[model samples]
Every structure is written in C-alpha cells, then in structure tokens.
Target: MKFLLTSGGISNDSIRNALVDLLGKPISESSALYIPTALYANPNGPAMAARLIRGETNTAPFPDGFTSMCELGWKSLGVLELTALPSIDEKCWLPLVKETDALLVEGGDPLYLCYWMRQSGLADLLPELGRETVYVGLSAGSMVMAPSIGEDFVGWKPPTGGDRTLGLVDFAMCPHLDHHDMPDNSMANAEKWAAGMPVPAYLIDDQTAIQVVDGVVDVISEGHWKLFTQE
Candidate 1:
C-alpha cells in the first residue's frame, strides 16, 4: 500500500507543490475520510472544524487551488456525527469506509480518537482497508498508525491502563516538529525514546510528509518534516 502521512494541512504554495510531487498525478478521484467525531468533545469544535476541512475557514487554508482535487473528483467524506458506541458500526463506520480511495484523518485529540478507533473496531478493520485503500494520516491521525503513541497533547494519554496500538505501521510518529506547544526539548525527547528502539521513527511538522510505498520509505517533503530514523 502507498501511504502519505503529514503533520498537518498544507497552506504554503511551495508545500502544495511538494505535496503534488509526493501524491504523484492526482487520480481521477480521491475520497477524504474526515473523522470529525475524533474532535467532537467541544460543542463548537466539530462544526468549526468542518469549515476548515471544507476549505471554508482558516486564514491561510491549504490554498484554494487544492480544492480542485476535491472538486474535479476527490470526494471528501466525514459527514456523520457519531457519539455512541453501537452507533459506530451500524450508523457511521461501515458506510464511511466502504468505497474510500484514501482515508484522510485530520489532526485532533489522538487519545479520544484512538479510543474511538478501538471501540469502533477500526483498529481491526484498518488492515482490511489496506487491501485496497491508501491510508493518509495527518498529525494525531499519523500518530495512531503506530504501535505505541508518544506523549502528545491532542490525543488521549493512557490512564492507569495500556493498550498496544493497531500496529499497522512499524514506526512511531510524533507531530508538530519543533513547535513550542510540544515538549520543551522535542528532539531530545524523541532521541531518548529511540535510544532502545529497533525500528525507524519520524518527527514531522505541518508542512512535511513521508510516503511509504511497498517497503520503501521516502521523504515526500521536509518543509517542517524530519525523520528520526532510529527512534
């Protein structure tokens, strides 16, 4: 499977160019699977996020031109609002993932999102999706694609309990690059995490992304993306 993982959305023109380089020629259509439920805790957050996802918000949003990717054919999907567990499989889960070309998960609280992913059986369902779909995880989305999550602000931190992640991707991903909102010394902490690790690691920024195709991993863009490789 081909994966395009990013720290966050791209708003810079140069970054946009870089993304097109990574994505290669646009397919006839690409479906965006937006998991707004992952960001549903705040009353206004989900709705507010929709506009941003729909390209109706954000001062310097991911550029108006990219909308053509959606307009010309890319179909954006995160339309259902789910709150209950049973509602997941029946009402929102199955249909949302049915015919997707790519699953684009936006950045949100990884904790809550991961919780929902487990509860909703998405963790189990993911590999099945891999049979045909390319999973594009951004920020919190990307972090959950790993075996275990690093300490991150937007996602849930395990409380007295531990659950190994879905383990689809062999590496752990940390988002936000050198941003102050994260650890005081981000690279130092990342290095510490990698000290005894056996697989490659990646610390990404909003403008950066990495594409994992077949078994080869390549730097798709580095505007703000950095790969720790050993952590």
Candidate 2:
C-alpha cells in the first residue's frame, strides 16, 4: 500500500512531488477521486465541500477542500462527496474511483468517515484499489487508516463503539500537535496522551506528514513531529 498520510492536505512542493512520483506519472496524466465525506459531520463546516474538486473552487468554511489541492499546485479530474454516493449501490461510484490515480481523503471526524466508508462499501474496495493508487489522507483521513482510533488518539475521543478504524496502519496518529492555529494541541498534551496509548502514536502538525510507501516508513515535513509510545 502506498499512502501519503498528512496532518493537513498536501501543502508543499516536497509533498506534491512525492505524491506525483508515487503515482509514477506526471500530474497532467493522472486523475484523482476526491473524497470529502469526513466533513459531512462537522457542525461548523460545509455539508459538501464543493460539487467539483478542481482548481477554481472555493472551500469556504472548511479547512481543506478542492482549493487545498489547488493551492498546493496539484490538480484532479474527478471529485466526489462520499456522502452523496448511494450506499447500497457500489456501481454508482466504483468506476470513477477505479479510474483515478489518486484518492484524496479529507480531514474532520474520523469515525464519521469510517462509518460512511463501511456503509458505502468503500472500506472493502479500498484494500484492493489501494494497491494500485495513491491514498492521500489529511488529518482525520490519516487517523481512520490506523488500526485503531483509541482514546486521545488523534486528539479526539473514540467513536461510541470504541476503536473503529480501518486498521490499515499499525499505529494511531494524533495530528495537529503544537499547531499555532490549533490552540488546544501541544507537545505537553501529546506527551500525556501518548503515555496512555496502547500502541505507538505519531504526533504531527500541519507541515508534517507520515509517508508510508510499500513497507518503508519516513517522516516528511517542513515542520517537526514526534513518535510517542509507551514502548
């Protein structure tokens, strides 16, 4: 599986280059299927980011959206709101997903995203499609891919059902650490959070991302992040 797990969306030249290179094709030749379902449950955010995830759209109140990709100098041909897809009919959404070179998952509520992923059946299709495409995850998008989104994991409470993550990654991620814009997150809080986690945790900020290609893991960022664990 090739994944660019970022605290924020692709925000720098290095991250964009890595995604393009991972696709093994120039951005012009590649297409993406933008998935913004995580925003569906946010109280203050938009119900849908934009009808189209393209260069000329406004993200509005949402922290990230099509405009995030545009700002990073990247582009995509397909844009989808996972919330809009018919949960019972995979046929309605599968083709576009298969046609894309990348799948960009947005940030917000991790459990909410997970619930829809399972409901839409994308959760099952993902393991197979992931082998052939780049999975770009931002914040909550990155958190859901982990084995579990436990207590204090990713700076949020676990969903009502407990650790309901996709289990794609071995560790949990607590993103937005010490981010000046996110006042509640800090290194001190991260340290306290890490000490109680059952597994290793990654504390990342907006400029930081955890890039996992195949089985190799690397920390890529213009800012600082830390690996915290009871181990």
Candidate 3:
C-alpha cells in the first residue's frame, strides 16, 4: 500500500501539481475515496448542535466538499460517514473500499475523528485497505494514520473522553507544517508530543508529501519536509 501525506487541503495549484507528480497520474486514473471525520463549517457547531432540542445541523454538507475535491481531479467515490454506519451492514463496506485505487482522508480534529474511527470498525479495516491500495491523507487524515495526534495545531475537544486510534502508522504526522496561518509553536508542540511516542514524527509543509510504496517511505516534495526519528 502507498500513502501520500499532504500538509493541508489540495487547494493550491502547486500542491495539486505535486500530488499528480507523486501519484504518478491524474486522479481519474486512481479510484479516489474520501473519508470525513468532521464536516461542519462552523467551528463550534458540534457541541452547540448537540444541545439543541431538535432540527440541529448535526451533519454538515459532505457531498459538497466531496465534489470540490473531485473538481481538483480526484475521482471521489464516497465519504465514509463514520458516525452513520451502525444502521448499515458490514458486508457492504469492505468490497467498496477494496475496489478503490486510492483513499483520501480530509482534515478535521484528529482527536474527535479518532473517537469516531474507534466507534466504527473503519479503523480496524484501514490497514487492510492500505495493503491493497494507495492512501492519500490530508490534515486530520494524516494525523490519525500516526500512532497519536500531535498538538502542532488546534484540536477538537471530545464530547466526553479521549479516544485511541487504530494505530496504522508507527509515527504521528503534523500536516500544514510551516503554514503561515498556523501558530509558531505548532511544530514545537508536535515534536514534544512525538518525543514520548519514541517514534519518528514528520512535519510536512504545504506542497510537500511523503510517499510510501510497498512499505518504503520516500519524501517527495517541492519544499522542506522535516523528519524527527529518535534513534
């Protein structure tokens, strides 16, 4: 399985071009799959919506975002609604992902996303997907792939308690490294968090990506890609 870790959304032309260069073809050639953990535009919506008596917008417009990602040349197959799966049967999911060529995980709160991933069986099934196809991960998507989410950026507060991730990748990744919009301490905090894991951590700046193919990870980018592996 191959993995692409981007610092942020594919909103920039350079980043998009870099993705094409790394993926080895246009997204149409790849079976694009997008995963969303949080979709609301409003930052405070989740907690606020939970308290509303009725008609609260618990779920945001996910398809719109999916379409946007596709416009960038991604063949977005579906957004795995981690929170909405218990009502469905499991036999229906594996085949869907197994057939895809690539899987994209969009950005959001890693902690909150991880919370839902555990609630659903998707976390357990991701490694299987990895072994079979390519995995493209953006912000939160990159974070969850790691052993733990880093504190380099703002994170979500769980409704109640903390949640553990599926532990697919050995290291934690902090996407959007050196993004002008992020606070200066983001990388430092992430590095500190990773120190305890005793595993390598990466700070990937925008327009940069880490490509993992057949278990061999190579840094591919047009900019700085920092790696912190404690020997």
> Each candidate: RMSD to true structure?
4.5, 3.3, 6.4
Cα lDDT of all candidates, in order? 0.58, 0.73, 0.61
Model 1 over residues 1-231: C-alpha lDDT tens digits? Answer: 456666764434554554455445454445656565555554466564666555664322233322311222353444433346456446545766756666666556666667777776766677666545666666666766677665434334546445345566788776666665555437776566555444667766665666676757766554555456642
* Best-first order by TM-score: 2, 3, 1
TM, every model? 0.73, 0.85, 0.73
Q: Please report the TM-score between candidate 3 and the true structure.
A: 0.73
Best by TM-score: 2
**lDDT, ranked from best to worst:** 2, 3, 1
Q: Which residue pairs come into collision in candidate 3?
A: 7-176
Backbone clashes under 3 angstroms, per model: 4, 0, 1
* Alpha carbon lDDT at 224, candidate 3: 71
Q: What residue runs in model 1 are displaced by over 4 Å at the alpha carbon? A: 10-28, 41-44, 59-73, 76-85, 88-96, 152-160, 180-186, 193-199, 229-231
Report the lDDT tens digits of candidate 2 across residue range 1-231.
588999867766677778787889887777777777887677644634552243334533324322365334345555677666754476777887877788888787898888778767788888887566888898888989987776664333334577668988788788877876666679998778777767788988777888887767888887778998685
Error of 1 at 131 (Å): 4.4
Cα deviation of 113 in candidate 2 (Å)? Answer: 0.3
